[model samples]
Target: MAKNKDVRVTVILECTSCVRNGVNKESTGISRYISQKNRHNTSSRLELKKFCPYCYKHTVHGEIKK
Candidate 1:
């Protein structure tokens, strides 16, 4: 028997505000999150609202290349 393929893939989400700002004013790093998405359900890039410690506010986090 062959192993089944995984339907869920891991994706990296990055803070949009931090990228646009070039650098975080309060911190020296960008906010990032790890999540899983269904390949069959969503083919497009994933975007979510999450809290950023560097930004100190909730912002849009978009999926990025690994």
Candidate 2:
């Protein structure tokens, strides 16, 4: 069980543009991504540049609390 905590964890990334600009209101849902990151290597929240289908552009996707 202790070893599991040290492994990469699954995280959800949400589009910053869609949330800040209220673009999700028009669409059925907001853009989200599932990824894994090393807990030991990346102590801080992860952010990545990803494509937002609703926004129709690439935007910064930040980690959200599960």
Candidate 3:
């Protein structure tokens, strides 16, 4: 496991296209890919999620700057 303290929010992807429009940005074609890609250095981990749009939900992803 990793420390959540270093974990901070980085982005919020609008997941309307996945469930509602049936689109895929990446991953298993999940609702959203919220990320810490903008973070300094870490790992890409999924932190939070919500029901996809249509289901009106989204997913949170974390990115480690490398």
Task: Give the candidate number with the greatest lDDT.
Answer: 1
Q: State the weakest 10-residue window (summed lDDT) of model 3.
A: 57-66
CA lDDT, candidate 3, residue 6: 49
Q: Taking the tens digit of each residue's C-alpha lDDT, what string does model 2 give over 1-66?
A: 345454679999999988898776668778999999999899899999999999888999999999
Candidate ordering by TM-score (highest first): 1, 2, 3
TM-score, per-candidate, Cα-based: 0.89, 0.86, 0.25
User: Candidate 3: what lDDT?
Assistant: 0.47
TM-score of 3: 0.25
Q: Which parts of model 1 are misplaced by more than 4 Å?
A: 1-4
Question: How many residue pairs clash per model?
Answer: 0, 0, 7
Higher-TM-score candidate among 1 and 3? Answer: 1
- Give the Å error, residue 10, model 2: 0.2
Best by TM-score: 1
- Candidate 1 matches the true fold with a TM-score of 0.89
Worst 10 residues of 1 by lDDT: 21-30
lDDT of 1: 0.94
lDDT for each residue of candidate 3 in 1-66, tens digit (9 for 90 to 100): 976854355665545445454664444554544545434563444345555544434453332233
